[model samples]
Target: MSGHSKWNNIKRKKEKTDGQKAKIFTKIGRELAMAVREGGSGDPAVNSRLKDAIAKAKANNVPNDNIDRIIKKASGEGNSDAYEAIQYEGYGPSGVAVIVETLTDNRNRTAGDLRHYFDKFGGNLGTTGCVSFMFQKKGVIVIEAEGLDEDEVMEAALEAGASDFQSDGDVFEIFTEPEDFSAIRDELAGKYTFVSADVEQVPDTYTAITDPDLIVKMGRLLEMLEDNDDVQSVWHNWENADDAE
Candidate 1:
């Protein structure tokens, strides 16, 4: 499995904790709002971003009524002006390149908070494009592999334009070019139960941070960013397995 996948599994394992679930809901809600605003419609059939957002919400077990209410409000143009997508680049502990994706109403507040968090956690936020060059944006889809054959899935995914396929436990992850995401997703829609699907910047190479203290500091920084309402996702090049027990 990729280091990204491993770190995700660790986070997922932690989601059962009460405090973490609240943070997860906040992040998902922000994503839904941003998606609805950007797509300009709440109808999933016509809005690709909204469709993905709904899928993610369902995956996280977000309340159906809450999801519907958000869509209704978004469609009616009440909160559309309050959200904007922003990207931030930086270096985490041990010089691990990091990229943060956020949807915020107040850019200044988000920027200041992010910088403060980085400084507090032994990292520094850099200007745009400073660390992004070390990564490539790609679409990743994770599906339960209970009823599917790994080899068959791999073959199908490759034929459907997937760039890579990996099995982590009973989960199968399919990666594709950003443009090919919807095509691959549509092809496998009914064949598997998709756990989560999203576009992310995958680091081209990892910075192996073997020091335990540095790893703890980096993880703390990532958690802090993830907890922020404006922050949607955080990506970095640090390989945690080298230091994580």
Candidate 2:
């Protein structure tokens, strides 16, 4: 499995915890709000961003009532939280390349929090393109593997314009060009259940922390970053990502 798929599998297990699920819902809700404000409409039919956000929220198993409420609030007047997307690139312990993406109303607070997490956890933040050059943005759709044949899923996904497909024991992962993700996911959704569907930063290279001490610090860094409400996503090619299972 690629880095993106592996990290997603880890998160899937974590979602079983109510606290973690609540955090996931909060993150998705923020994305939904941002989509509505930026896309200028709550109707997913006309707003591509909102449409994608709704699909992701559904894939994450968020309740429809919550989704409806978020959409209504986002589309109404006086929803004044204006979040701007910001990305921070840095290196974690053992020189693991890390990227933290955020939707923040206050840039300074988000940046400072991210910097502190990196510095206090044995890493250093860098300029905009420092580690981003090693990552690619792609659309990833994950489906539970239960009762599904890998070959069958591969064939259908290929026909629907997926760039790649893999069955990673617990889940079937489909990759697509960012532009094709929504269309392909919509096609697959008709016949299969999804674990998740989102556009994500995928790493081209992985950094392994062989030293046990570095691993501990790296893990803590990831936890702190993920716990931040402003942080939307964190991408890193940590070799032991599957260890989270």
Candidate 3:
């Protein structure tokens, strides 16, 4: 398995062990709020960014009522929460490039927490663009393979404007241009239940950490980033020894 799938495995375990579903709602809520401010509209029909956010929330199993409520509340007055989207780039143990995407109102607190986690776990947060160049932003959509024909899924995804498609025996992955993500996802939504559909930072390369000590520290570094409330998504290029083998 690739590191992305391995990390998704870790995330799945963590979410079930804790109340991470509620945390996911909060993160998507912040995204909806920010999308309204950035796009200056509550109607997803007119605001493409809001449309994408709504789709993402829905794909992740957020209730339609909650999505509507968040957008409506954000469009009204007296809502003082303005989330700024900031990305932190860094190098983890074994020089694995890490990029943390966050939506937060308090930059200082977020910065301090992220810095502390990196420093404590043998990683160092770097300046902007320090590690981002090693990555590319892409729209990735995943669908479970159970009770679904692989060929049908592949055909549908391709017909819906997906640039590439792959299956790992248990799930199908669909890739598209960032601009085509929303439309392609919407098209597939009519036919399949999405495992996840979002724009993600994909690393161009992977760094394999075979040393057991650095592997444990890297795991800690990832956990700290994942547990933070302000963190929306954590992207890295670290490959485990098992994957390397």
Candidate 4:
């Protein structure tokens, strides 16, 4: 993980086409709905999960109207979309550990599509615990670093319960234990704009694919998984993923 870059990943997502942006919006909407259901409240103040989901939606440029509408709908009766959270662990090319997180109403369809993608790209989907051992879940908060003072931000983050802080090229990454994520994020939100705020599966180590063919295949595998509507997040241990992007 020596060269891992979170800012680069944010830039890539921001540069995607409008169609892709729509998919992202849809995925976040699903997240909002789930948050409301799981938290049993539409009010972000009372429902921490819904508050965190709203922050993530805003960071991705989701409009206020859209966010409110989604929450209202999710809280209302007659909301029938029942999405189950599923995590699939596997290996990408060259033994790179991969984890795909999804929210799906139909497990059969999602599983089959993911299996095909992995197989076609020289990887294979494995059991639930197959590759998850290599990862730890943490809350990640990113703020743009254009004019912010790193020392000030780091101090505030640490004081607010963040466990780690790093300044990437164009963003500051603040990490916290999963349990402290919401509190820290809410504290920082009062003063700074977020680029992204969400709990994520972070890799413990990194792998690099030296073979050109495997590199190409690994890239495609990730793309396919990300493009799927059911997939909420994809985490991997590819150290050179910045180059692939």
Better structure of 2 and 4 per lDDT: 4
Better of 3 and 4 by TM-score: 4
Who is ahead in lDDT, 2 or 3?
2
Pitting candidate 1 against candidate 3, the one with the higher lDDT is 3
Best prediction by TM-score: 4
Please give the TM-score that candidate 4 achieves against the real structure.
0.95
**Model 3 C-alpha lDDT per residue in residues 1-245, reported as the tens digit of each score:** 12355436534543553377788888999999999989999999899999999987876678999998999999999889888999999999989999999999999999999999999999999999999998888898888889999998999999999998988777788989999998898898889987777888877889988888888888888877877899999988886623422
Better of 2 and 3 by TM-score: 2
Clashes of each: 0, 0, 0, 0
**Tens digits of per-residue lDDT for model 2 on 68-178?**
999999999998878899999999988888888899999999999999999998999998999999989999888888898899999999999999987768788899999
lDDT of 2 at 142: 83
Per-residue lDDT tens digits of candidate 1, residues 124-182?
Answer: 99999999998888888887778889998889889888999988776788999988887
Q: Where does candidate 3 have its weakest 10-residue lDDT segment?
A: 1-10
**Model 2 alpha-carbon drift over 4 Å, by segment:** 1-16
Backbone clashes in model 2, listed as residue pairs: none
| lDDT of the candidates, in the order given | 0.80, 0.86, 0.84, 0.90
Judge candidate 1 at residue 155 and give its lDDT: 90
Number of the top-ranking candidate, with lDDT as the measure: 4
lDDT of 4 at 200: 88
TM-score list, all predictions: 0.89, 0.93, 0.91, 0.95
